[model samples]
Structure formats: structure tokens, C-alpha cells
Target: MLNSKLLHKKLFLDSGLKTQVKEVNTSNLEWTKNFGDIAPFMQLDLRLIWRNKRTKSSVWMLALGLLYGLFFYPNPTYNNMPFFFIFIGIFSTGIFLINFGQFVPAWDSGYYKLLMSQNIKYEQYLKSKFTLMALSVVILFVLGIPYVYFGWKILLAHFAAAIYNIGINTHVILWGGSFNRKKIDLSQKAAFNYQGTGAVQWLIGIPLLVLPMIIFALFNWLLSFEIACLVLTVMGVVGIVFHQKLMRFITGKYLESKYKMIDAFNQDN
Candidate 1:
């Protein structure tokens, strides 16, 4: 009477083998099911983020990022300089990726040890983070569709930026986080808080934000605005295609830096 697959899942849950169950014949199961096992990490991540007064307050930054275009959209000064749109595109869509990602494991500094003790695969842990950031980029891009009112070019820039954020910048931020995991005091006020910031965080912007702008500007100058958008989009698409490889690489880096991160996180505690 019960669907066989659902029955198996029910048994797995009831037997407490949810995370350890394997496919009948294959050496590996589907990635979706494996990721499902670690899905609770995503929920925990969301709770921790909301629990942090400072991180929770970053919603204002997202609000400001969305409205940032008002400054350029209405100003005739920016009309001739369409290149600036790329800056807004990157910032508006990738604000969350940039703000939350650079901290990486540092955000879990409060419980870095306990988290490490858990049975979670490092790849799954990082995947949960990647999913959150990629989702944010999609949401921000959709919300920014209203920017099309300015011009289709504005929309194009935002699309390219969103793709870039989802594909490239998310991995870039995660990889950058591998180095210099700083301790954060989540209880502190969000205003001008420099609690967890370090040189790596500042330098990461060069790739996450500046490099795309430079690439776009060069293509725009050498060819045309549409070509520039296409180039950025292609770069993002390439990154998306190789996301798994990038995640594996970043996961290894996290493993290598795990002890270092724990030691660093313990300094303040």
C-alpha cells in the first residue's frame, strides 16, 4: 500500500540510518539525496545568521544595495558613463554573497569545534553555504527586474551581474574565506562593526567585485556594451559549469585550514 521508495525512506528515518543509508547496487547514491542528508545544516545556518544581531541587520545593506541605482539612474552625469551600471549590478545582486560569505567558517567560530565534531562532510557543509548564496543572488536579481524601467541595458547589466555572482563570486568568496578565519562577536551592534574583518576580506573584493568591473570596462571599450555583457555572462556560465570542481577545491582548502581556523577561533574564547 505504501509507495516502495517512500517506505524505504520511512524505514531509514525510523531506523536512524537516514544519513548512512546507501543505494542498493550503486557505490554512490544521487547527489540530491546525499545533499538532503546535510540539508539541516542549511536550516541551522539560517538560524545562526538570524541569531546574530549584526548579520541580521545586514538586511539594511541589501535595501541600500537595491536603491543604490537611484543615484546613477536619475543623474545625467551617469548617462554617458554606462560602465558604472556594472558596479551597481554586482553590488545589488551579490550584496549577500559578499557580506556573508567572506566570513565563511568564521561565522561559526562560536561553535566551530562542535561543528567540526559532527559527521557532516566538509563538501556538504560548503554546499549548504553555496546554495544559500546562490539563492540570494537569484532573489536579488528577480527583485531587480524593475530596474528594466531605466533601460534594457540596465536589465542586461544586472542579469550579467547576477549570473556572475551566482557562478563566480560565490565560489570566490568561499575560497577566499579559507584563509584568515577571524572571530566574530555576534552579540555586538551591526553598525560599523569590524569584528571579523581582516586583510583577506578587503583583498577579496578585488576579484569578487573589481575584477568583473574591469573586465566589463575593457570589453565595453574594445568592442561594445552588449559584447561586454555577453563576456561577463560567459565567464559566469563557465564558472557555473565547473561549480562542482570548484566546490571540491574549496572544500579541500577548508579541510587544510580547519585546524588553523579552530585554533584561531579559540584565541578569543
Candidate 2:
């Protein structure tokens, strides 16, 4: 009788162990599948951006932003002015964000419904957009390194702006994306493409760009330029530190608006 009891206990433990192993393997497989989905989506986005004229203009815009340093570098007064960095910060980091982000799911309006029918998660879609924009920020910063000739402070400001952009503005733009309902024609020339313009796109700039500039301006005016830069950098650092929480919140917002976005994207306009 004791042997029978021991045999039963061993079988039960073996069964539990097998179940645990199966669960872990299932989870790992799902994770890998999700990872695979993201890579293809990201690659598709890159290819589309390269092939589409309007989206491709983002590269030129970034180039223009890098040249902004040329305008201020020669003038000692302008070079030293703190407000100058604020302007550069906005343009440099915001180039791709403003151009591409304002369109959001609308950019895929032509095939948005088809995409929705797929097995993709809203989190994955939003993450792809965020990841692409974050990457552009890095590339733009690298291109803007020539501005370091003006002063290390210029480089410092650019770094601060890049941090704030990736950490804060990226999520803000995605959150704003929840409100995008207009359709954009990627084939159109970027020069005057207003296909997807909306109030939310316009209003987003205030928080993403203006608020930081305001903070910097006020501090630079009242305290010192150095203090203002530090303040902006600190704000950016805080945002970077809390990025995961912000993404989670943004993902919730996307989920809440998922149906609405799909409906909006289907419209003829």
C-alpha cells in the first residue's frame, strides 16, 4: 500500500512538471512569433517610405534640419543664444515626427481594413511606428553631428532634444495618432500634401514642441542658459526613464480607439 501511494505521488509531480515545461515552451514560441511579426512590419514600413514620394521627403526635411546649424554657426551672438538651440531642437527632432506621425494609421488607409483582419496586435502596430520614428531621431542626430563645430553646447542641446523627442514626443505623436481619421495619398508630392491634416495634428505641436520651448525660454530668461538646458535635459531623462509606462498608456489609448480608427480610415476622404 505504501508503494502504491509513492507511485501515485511521483506520477502527479511528473505530470505537473510536464505541464510547466509545455507552458514555458508555448510562451516562448508566441514571443518569437510576435517578434517575427514586428520585423516584417518594420521592414514593410521602410520600403513603403522609400518608394513613396511624400514619405521619402522626410529624408530631405531631416537634411534641412541639419543645415540649420549653418544659419546660426557663423554669428557669435546667434550661436550663443539659448533660444537658438530650442528652435534647432524642435526642427531637428521633429522633422520626421511631424511629417510622418501626423498621418498615423491613415497612411495605411488604402489597406487598413485588410491589415485589421490580420492577426496583428495593436501594440505591435504602435510599437513599429514608435520604433521607426525613434530610429529616425537617432539618424538625424548622427547627421547633425557636424553642428558640433559651432560649439559642444550645440551638440549638447541636440542630444537633449533627441532624448526628449524619443522619450516624450514619440509617445505623444502615437497618442495623437488615435485621433487621426483623414486619409493621406502617399503618392502625392510632399510639397503641399495636406491630405491628412487635422486639428489634432496641429494641436499636438503645442505640447510636443511649444511646451518644452516655453519651459526653456522662461528658465533661460529668468535664470541662466545653462540652467535652462539642464532643465530640458532633466525633463527628457525623466521621460526616457518612464518610457515603458508611457508606451503602455499609449497602447491602451490605441486599443480604445482601434475601431474608430478603422472606421475613419475606411472613409473615401
Candidate 3:
């Protein structure tokens, strides 16, 4: 009876061992890519974008929209429709872009260290940033339609122009975002002070939201919406591609010289 019990215990132990081994082999950690090629950037960006109130750059836009709806644009007619639609596009896109910036660490000497710690491929990183930007643009494009009281004819033109504006802002943000040196946090007292960007940074971002308005005014002035959209589309495609090339070049330079900066910051900290 004792021998039989020993044999049974041995069998149970062996079975337990096998199950443990199988679990280890099938664990989520064993899976390689957490989020695919663009996962790192997207993950990083998404985290950073919503970490603070200022990160809700969309708030300012919402305020502007509410103000407009309440004051300047209570009801919609053909005369005010153009301005209303353009405002909607700008504010909407601005919200996404604002939040997108929050995800990015400032491209300062400090951020270079974090970036270099990994073996991330440049193209993959760039693609990730581009994809996020596209998502934001799509959100604005879709949402702006409701605010604008126009048919698909006008909608299509605004869509193209708004997308073009997103492209332009993406390129611009990439340039500014490459040097993040600030720590991102969503909580603290004296809340505004804890946020990284200052008034100047906020001012710079204004243009991104304002581009749609500019385009609308220009188109309105010319009295040719289709031609204006074509021009904006051409500009958007060219600008976005050009920014990619520029990003590649700039990052290469920053990578080459960024080591010393990283070392200094690390040593100081």
C-alpha cells in the first residue's frame, strides 16, 4: 500500500511539471511583437497624448466650438456655412493633433538616450508616427461633416483640404517632437506648471488648427472651391513626403551627435 501511494505521488508530480512547462511555452511573453512594427510609436504616442489636461488639447478646441456655436454661428445659412464648416474642420483636426503631441516626448537631448536604448528601425518608427497621424486625420474628417451643413459635394473638398492640413501638421510636429526632454505626467497640483509645453509651444500649435481656416478663406476669396482643394491636395502630398525625407535626414544627424548629450543628462540626473 505504501509503494502504491509513492507511485501515485510520482505520477502526479510528473503531470504537474509537464503542465507548467507547457504554460511557460505558451505564455504571452513568448510572443514576440507586442504591437507590430508601429506598436512602439503608437503605444508611446497614445500614452503621452492623454497623460495630462493640456494633453487634452481638444479642450481648447471644444471651447472654441462652443463659443462659436453660442455666439458667432448660432444657426447655419449659406453665407455663414463656409466659415462654420471650416471652423469645424480646423478645431476638430486641432483636437487630434493637440492630443497627438501629448504622446510625444520632446525631441531634446534627453529623449535621444531613450530612443537609442533600443534597436528600433527608423522606417518602422516613421511609419508608426505616420499611421497615428492618419488616424487622427480620419477622425477629424469624419466628425467635421456633422458640424458642416453641406452636401457631399462640399464635404469632399473640405475632406481633402482637411487631410492636407493634417499632413502639414504631422510634418511640423515631427520636427518639434524629435527633441522631447520633459517627463510626462497626468497628475500633480499646480497642474499647468507640471505640463511640459509653455505658452510659446501652445502658440505654435495654433497654426495647425488655423490652416483649415486659411484654406477656406483663400478658397472663398478665389470663388473656386474645386481649384482650391486641388491646390491644397497637391501641397499636402508634396509636403508630407518632403517631411519624411527631412525627418530621416534630421534624425540621422541627431543620432550621430546625441550620445554626448544623453550622457551629460544621465550623469546630471
TM-scores, all candidates, are 0.85, 0.81, 0.61
Task: Give the distance in Å from residue 186's predicted Cα in candidate 3 to where it truly belongs.
Answer: 4.0
Best by lDDT: 1
C-alpha-based local distance difference test score of model 1: 0.85
**All models: lDDT?**
0.85, 0.79, 0.56
- Name the Cα RMSD for model 1: 9.9
| Residue pairs of candidate 2 with colliding backbone atoms | none
Residues 103-127, candidate 3: write the lDDT tens digits: 3543222365677678667556655
Q: Per-residue alpha-carbon lDDT of model 2 for 1-269, expressed as tens digits?
A: 99999987777777889999997765342432355667666766776777888788876777777676777677887855777787687678668876778778777887887888896787778878887888788888888887787778778878878877887788888889888888878899988767788898889989888887888889989998778878877877887788878888988887788788788877867
Order of candidate numbers by lDDT, starting with the best: 1, 2, 3
The local distance difference test score of model 2 is: 0.79
How does model 1 score by TM-score?
A: 0.85
Tens-place lDDT per residue, model 1, 41-126, is: 77677767776797786565778777889878987787777688899999999888888888887888888988898856999899
Index of the highest-TM-score prediction: 1
